[model samples]
Target: MQSTEQLDEIWQDRAIESIINFVRSADGDFNCIEKLANAVSDPDSLQKIVEFLSSTSQGKQAFQKRPLLGNIDLQKLHRLPTNSLGYSFANHLLTNNLQPLQRKSVENDYEFFAAHITETHDLWHIVTGCDTNILGEIQLEAFYVAQLYASRFWLALITKNLLKTVIYDIELSTTYMDAIAKGWVMAKQAKPLFGIEWNLLWETPLEDVRNSLNIILPSS
Candidate 1:
């Protein structure tokens, strides 16, 4: 747990390193992403998220209990109905080689804010119809930018990566840009996913969850 006084310095240093790695690849190294999240300090954004969560029944319970997705049972998820979000997420994890999330050290409320967002990263992908590919990763970050009120870290990554692609691979620039645009629209139209109790929804039908959240898959 880092002290409040140390947060600014720590975040700036880590943000710089995270940017360099992100330029080379959109995935941006899992560990680096965590550090970058830890570096961000936005009290207003966090307060708004807290207020949003507090306003809903499910969100209230989620905030009070602080349920973690890591506690999810992979075997049970596998046994869920094929059309269930849980089953799909379990399969997604296995197929994509994505590791279960780990908790970051929380020195204060702000750190906890960072930790919560880090933990929910994959759930966002699951709900947003994004995949684990490079394009999907960038698009997801773009979605977060819009959803989180133009998160600086997410914006920085999206801008840097888009610029890089445009400079070296101009043809692919449109594709990446399109993904970002879709993410922005998708997030804007859908419910805020941060406060969701994903564990409870595992056994529920994926379509139902999507419909409830107003999450529509982009037509191909």
Candidate 2:
């Protein structure tokens, strides 16, 4: 007779179902991305990911302290210089009407990854100069794929979204691929975003932050 814990240990769920569902009906829901990530996550997988991150100097620094941005007061961020990362991020949130989506209790590597990534997600858009649109989101995922900084979690998201584009939305297919290519290219030109202390750079000029990270934005 298998104990409940024994069964849980032996039984592993595949990410296919979640990926397919997100593809078919995500319609730009961020929660779908969240759910998809959660679907494929387990201790062993997260440990591998953490191990990979630990290999890089930036990732090593990031993990040594395991920085978590949590939430910030948007109003305070808005007070920063207009050309600063903080102001731009605050403006982005205000324009999109999104909360900072504070950190959850992170007791393990997976939780820490999810919490920090979620907290910094919009900040990536700001620095990358990607808009809050389908194309922009796809590009960022593609960037994440190239960097592998987010691990296989992004691979699953990009795979589903790319399939969705090709299988159903044929008209935008070319543009989608172009965006992905540009994002992939963008990765080669930048430093690791994982270990960046973005919160500390809030008052720094946005361009300076980008330059420090060696970010090469695609033309508008």
Q: Which candidate tops lDDT?
A: 2
lDDT of each: 0.73, 0.79
Q: What is the TM-score of each candidate against the true structure?
A: 0.78, 0.88
What lDDT does model 1 reach? Answer: 0.73
Compose the digit string of candidate 2's lDDT tens values, residues 12-130.
44467777778887577778767777777766667877887778998887776778775688999999889999999999999888888677567766677667777888988888887
Residue runs of model 1 more than 4 Å from their true location after superposition: 1-21, 24-28, 31-35, 38-64, 104-108
Candidate 1 positional error at 161, Å: 1.5
Off by over 4 Å in 2: 1-13
> For candidate 1, lDDT tens digit of each residue in 55-100?
7686666566665655767777888899998898888878777765
- Cα RMSDs, all models: 4.3, 3.1
Candidate 1: how many backbone clashes? Answer: 0
The true-versus-predicted C-alpha distance at residue 206 of model 1, in Å, is 0.4
